[model samples]
Target chain A: MRPTVHHVAEEAGVSLATVDRVLNRRPGVRAKTVTRVNEAIAKLGYVRDISAANLAKQRVYNLVFIIPEGPNSFMLGLESELGQAKLYSALERINLDILKVRAFDSDALANVLDGLDLTQISGVALVATESHRVQGALARLRQANIPVVTLVSDVSAAHRDHYVGIDNVAAGRTAASLMGRFVGHKPGKIALLAGSMLVRDHVERRIGFEQVISAEFPELDCLTVQEGRDDAMVTRSVLADFLGREPGIVGLYSIGAGNRGVIDVLTSKPEYGSIAVVAHELTEHSKRALREGVFDAVINQDAGHEVRSAIRLLKASIDETQVIAKQEIIRIEIYIRDNLP
Target chain B: MRPTVHHVAEEAGVSLATVDRVLNRRPGVRAKTVTRVNEAIAKLGYVRDISAANLAKQRVYNLVFIIPEGPNSFMLGLESELGQAKLYSALERINLDILKVRAFDSDALANVLDGLDLTQISGVALVATESHRVQGALARLRQANIPVVTLVSDVSAAHRDHYVGIDNVAAGRTAASLMGRFVGHKPGKIALLAGSMLVRDHVERRIGFEQVISAEFPELDCLTVQEGRDDAMVTRSVLADFLGREPGIVGLYSIGAGNRGVIDVLTSKPEYGSIAVVAHELTEHSKRALREGVFDAVINQDAGHEVRSAIRLLKASIDETQVIAKQEIIRIEIYIRDNLP
Candidate 1:
């Protein structure tokens, strides 16, 4: 039979309340007593029944996920995954609440962060819009001892406890490498499409993409980037206009959302196959495009993984438990038609 | 407060013992009483604390992992992951035992399975070697009500409860697609390497690789496969012989282990960069090879993910619980130099 707290208390020669205080790291416990309890626990090989302890305490972690509200398919998919996570939230003893703010609006994001009830919320995760005001709000949360995690887009400041997303710069470099290889020896201009440069992920992706294109693929020239606000309609018009105006366009790299727009324009063109396309995120539109030989590659970060990792990190912080670092890494997933899903 | 069994029993006008029987699906409970208990549970939104319940029952799952004993880096890595899992086993109420048999010895594997004490083992997981003898053993286990999970490699017979691995056929096709694109328009032979044709994963990969090469890349010809038995010495000698005799080798596809030999042979040749290389399973050797430009790409199924998934599947099978399908999918991860992690 496994040892229990009673065994630990008897071995430590302490009262049950004293053992409990040491186990929970509560105040008013002397260092000598805490050491005695810990030695007894280690010697007895007593693995704490965390679930039973939590049940006894009725500890419910109140976690909030703050994401951008937009027409972006990827963000919508993230929200959908959070909705799915809610089904299992009760079993995990987590009360998950989602807050939506205007996309890329630093003032709105900061306002939302500043207005949070610190006492009610155990942790916070947000798709950050990098700005001084937002950084100040994050600092305030840190001062209040609330753990903060950045999801999807991370901030430049070091206020967050953890970042549960892929390395966007590496993702961009990978896209560039694939693009360079796919459009081998073709001397033509490459068109770059992004959601907005205001976000750190987009800017980092652009930097990595441009670095590779210039360093290796000298035959290809990158055209000026056009911001489409991640909207399908706006991206479609921007891409259509770019294609009409630019000559010798041989490659297209969609750094962010608005792949639906890129696909629409490419499919309607007669010489679509000549232009190698690489995009980010896998949605129904991108998956179909990949099958139809429209998009050569898609870079993805699993939204389910990110959401689940965030929850685990928040819970671990609240519990003061160790987490497996490797299991939490959000990999940069590269998908082609042959290896979808 | 979260509802307890007493609350459920009170709401249902039944005894606590009756509620326990219904919750645990034990026999001797009337259908009407079960319905009443279930209704009360639903009305109270009672989510069972599985860890606490298991603690109350003092349930410790004894799980066995059977794998082939070899110098194969991937399998070694899998074993290492299992070793790491052992550290957390006590906390999880799991007792993990690893059993090793001779590599590619069907009778040895079958004997190991046949010799298991079915009464003590809660579940079994194995890296399967498909054969009639093994199939019979699996069938006997199934009849004895032992939950079994196939890990890394799957068996053709449907005796196993779940397969915790990636689709090998799709992985092969993905390799072929990448090989064809990397060797664009080059008319030459492509060398195929495998551990052995005795395993199902290697055979399926060969089929998918050939299918794509014949249908799409007409310029490239697939050479006869070399069976290295996943040994470094055997692979090095065989590949060196092939390189000496075969003319105009433009690409290489490694379907299984023994990548250390491939890297040694390729690195020795001055024209290594001329050949496009794609191999399976990322290890220290493959990772370094990729960084050194010796490997164009590495197709990987995370060993850690596979091991963890197998454990989860086995436990869920034992508990008769539903698994999150999306979370369990083992993806065919494509790694380039830029995105190593």
Candidate 2:
């Protein structure tokens, strides 16, 4: 039989109400008595059913996902997914709020972070910036005992509680490996496109891609990356001009959110389809391009998984419970036309 | 402010105890009083926090997963995942029980289903056999108002409440597509292997694979399927014999759980490494084979994901709550060595 609060009370030789105070972390219990109850708890190996206890106590979690305000398809998808998650978690008493800051603005993110009412909010999940100001804000939040989870683009220097996204470096390496294999023994030049090197996720992906291409496919020449700034028009014009100048480019890897632009350039020229093209995310546009044979493969991190994972991590952190690392892992997904969902 | 039980009682013109009786669906509540309470619930748009109410009432879910007992790595992996899930859900007041019968024994499965004590069990998740007896057993369980979820191999004819696994047909098509692409434009024959055609999952995968191969890659000829009955030794000998007899075979798609046998044959003959091999599941053996370059790709339905999804579906079914279809979906995951987690 499992141990209960009564068991702990009996073992500690304390009243049920006194045991409840210790169990709930409520004040007014003597320090020595608290120690006795804790020892009894350890002896009995009692585990409190956190969700049930929280529910009975009418504990509600107020969470916020601070995302970037943008027209980026990936961010839009993330917002849509977060909205759905909020609806799904209504009964769980999780009030999920989405806060948007100007895209890529470190100061704007820091300002938002500073303005947060920590007393009312249980936890925060954010797309973090690398700026020291953001890091300082994160440290303050931590000091205040509110947990912070970094989302897609991480600010590792901030010492966040958890990261709720795929490993961008691994994702990039996987893309490079796919590009190398799909191109099949051909010695040709490969081009890479990214949003910007300033963003950690894109930079990590670029680093991973270059490493694999150099180590595994020495025959393949990797050209310098072109920054698209995650803008569709910029990606299209820049890629089209590059393709015209480099006829020898046999493969292209787009490691950011300008796939629409990449797809436009590739679809306009039927010859470009013969070149191995790989991109990130599985938005409606990417899905269609893969189906139309404009893109060979896609590397994806499910937005739903990311949002849901963030919620779980934040709740566990708030409850001071152990997180199941393996269960919380957000997978790096690969999609081809045949496997697209 | 959110509507409370007091508000509900006031709206229904009922006493607090009467409201409790109606909410709990207890005996002795008049039908007219029940109707009044339900009308109040709808009128106020009051959504009951099921988890909270269940906690207050100390409701515990007794769930059983009827899995096939086998040496098959994938089934073993599923069992292991379920065990871990049971541990994880201990705090959720979920008592998850695993009932094992002889692998692929329809009568044994039917007998187990027949013997279920519905009074004690809240719900069941099972890997079902497509037999009249099994279907009849499932029908009786449903008639008893027990929620049933089909896992891994599905029993579609039984009209199970939910399916907590990948779409086998889609998984097969994905494998075929990867095989065709990885092997390049060479017009070579491909070999297909399976546990048994009697299993719905295997048969669906075969159908999906053949459909894609026939439609997209007319150059590649698909050879007849060989069943290994999910035995590693049987798979090894059969595949080794087939490889010897068919020199034109350039790719092999193993659609079932005997990948160790497939890997044994392939690794023994270094020359066979040229053939692109794709299979199912990501067991330790498959992971090593993929890393060692013996297997090119693996199509996976995460065992952990399946077990968790089954639990969620069963709990939701018991509560008569809406299931989030997207969140519950078990992804048809594709893994190459680069992306294997």
How do all models score by TM-score? 0.97, 0.95
Q: Give me the displacement of residue B163 in model 1, in angstroms.
A: 0.4
Candidate 1 residue lDDT tens string, A36-58:
99999999998778867775777
Instruction: Candidate 1: list runs displaced more than 4 Å.
Output: B42-44
Residue-level lDDT of model 1, residues B4-56, one tens digit each, is 88899999999999998998889999898899999999999886777578757
Docking class of 1: medium
- RMSD of every prediction: 1.5, 2.1
| Residue range A128-228, candidate 2, lDDT tens digits | 87798999999999999999999988887447988888888899999988998889879999998998888999999998898899999998998989999
